[model samples]
Target: MAEQDTVRVGAFTVGMAEAEGWVRRYFDESRNREVAATGGRTRPYAYPVYDRFAAGGAESELSDGDLLAPSLLNASLGIRAVYNLQTLRPRLEKGLAAIPPTLTLTDAAARGTLASLLTDLFGVLDGPDPAVGLGLTTLSKILHRKRPLMIPLYDRRVKRCYCGDSGDHPVEPVSRSAPDGPFYAAVAAGIARDLAEQPVQWRYLASVAPADVSLLRVFDVVAWERGGTRDA
Candidate 1:
């Protein structure tokens, strides 16, 4: 969003080195330990429905006359959110049946071939909104549903890191609230960039580390980049 916004340079506590070592460590370890869940059956995502997340499933193909169409909303989350082979196959099958059996993939392998396929087809996968679904809740149970793993999930981290205990981290203007971030994205990028440019600890920057995979370390980056106090 604000790529060139005047970065509150000296205010950041965690420097480039800290982010590099921390983030990489956290990501690597999480990836190593946590087996990615198999789509819809996964924990918190289903929590959305339990929380009454009403976003419709992508249209069913073997249903009533006239396909419901492979919605952009369904496509968006299906493509990005469902990363496991077990779940991806079903989504791909549904996508193909409703849209074009040839739309995503016809045959999927169980050992994560679907995730691999989607990764390759990302270019085609990138398209209009399949749907727009948002249910905002900071209720402790809703917010702390799952421990954060590698790759920051954005919002909650933003609230915890930038906003502090209050829950409004690096409060980006409401208008800039997409995943790309007018605020959060910029801050994360800034910190990552600085970490990338660091001269010392070249290997740490080059490779993902074990510690930086979870929020335990992610908060440091979010806090530092979101304009949190350096002294903290």
Candidate 2:
């Protein structure tokens, strides 16, 4: 899609409010309690593991890096018992393992630490699942965690604003070889950075989502809304 043809879409989800709101509500006290009470207790279990893996600490009897830890491997148990991501463990693991085990990003601004980490994970030509690459995975992770992380839309919604449908959730693929299409990830990062009022919290994210995953498809969702901040 041409830059001129693209228009923006307000973030939204479910028919109630913007995607951000939907996310906030989902994470709200009641929902969290409900999910937890009704066997939705995934975050509790996985978070500690995730934290340990992220910090390269001790989660098991062995050293943090001893076996790439279950969290590093994207163990479904974490998603199911802790984060409740409800997707392919390997795919999630790809994203988790792909991230660098650090906080600082080389070009923290252009890609942020975590986002850039995804780039490092998939941008490689010899990487494991070279299909989606780091870009798309990062975008996918951003959208999925936006509500939880509080970052604004990644920008594909903005990129294809008035351009019309490209027959997919994310219009483009993160990388050229990513199994998906468009490079929508490039679109998300590009447009989000162009904005002047982007959220502060999600600024630094080192993430990945294996190869061939659409990032969006991994969560089975799509963006929809009207207008947003014209100033920022």
Candidate 3:
């Protein structure tokens, strides 16, 4: 199929050409990290964390590295100073146990399951204190790492892509202060529909993207790169 083919994903109609462009950009960025590592910079946190978690199997509990991954990815080193791993481990583990390791957000039932999980997990992760407290961006990042096929990353750019109103004026970005479980489910459902309807295209995208990145992440990069600027 030509890259220009468009598919409905979430609230937006995404073009394959555009999606491929953005996903390719994301791959290039991932490659750039390798270059950075050659310059003596520390190894990347994303793939390493993912590989470690996958290697340990679903029966394993979240480790200190799991907590630190999103923290470092978000550039919040201070989280380590106050976040009590012992205090949060049980809750985090409980939440993870409820969601199957191989779950994918690809249907109504799956979307509902994702919503319920996000509702419960978000409550556990978002707090007034900075330690356990994380905004949507960080929270989504953590969940995306844990369930790559199910959760889409929801940073500011992604919010702009899905939450904006159609008008001449710019829409205000959605608040990251709290998690919106329904919104996430909606996004998941849309992506599921796209993938279900466009299997060949999704397979093509998967083939082109980094092996470690999930289909969810592929769509995320597409939306993210296509998403409007914060001020736009």
* Root-mean-square deviation of every model: 14.8, 11.9, 4.9
Error of 1 at 205 (Å): 5.5
TM-score order, best first, reads: 3, 2, 1
**Candidate 2, residues 30-145: lDDT per residue as tens digits?**
55455556784353222223222343322112222422333222322222222222222334445445443332222233455534444443233234534322333333433232
Give the per-residue lDDT of model 1 (tens digit) for 1-232.
Answer: 2332212221233444545554454344244234344334332211122222333333322221111111211222232333332223444344333322222111232232333332222212223532122212111111121212211223333443433322323334452344322343233433343333332433343345333233323343334344434443
Candidate 3: segments with Cα more than 4 A from true spot:
1-4, 7-9, 28-30, 37-60, 75-77, 80-86, 107-111, 126-133, 167-183, 228-232
Tens digits of per-residue lDDT for model 3 on 1-232?
Answer: 5543864443565677777776675576566567666865554434444334443324427655565556535534345432654466677678767777677767434455656765666555444654444455765665567777666777766666555555421222353333455555554554566677777777777788777777877776666655653442
List ranges where model 2 is wrong by over 4 Å.
1-17, 39-107, 110-118, 124-188, 194-232
Instruction: Return the clash pairs for model 3, or none.
Output: 3-17
What are the TM-scores, per candidate, against the unseen true structure? 0.27, 0.33, 0.70
Query: Using lDDT as the measure, which candidate wins?
Result: 3
Clashes of 2: 26
Give the range of the ten consecutive residues with the poorest summed lDDT in model 2. Answer: 200-209
In lDDT terms, how accurate is model 1? Answer: 0.31
Q: Rate the local accuracy (lDDT) of all candidates.
A: 0.31, 0.32, 0.59
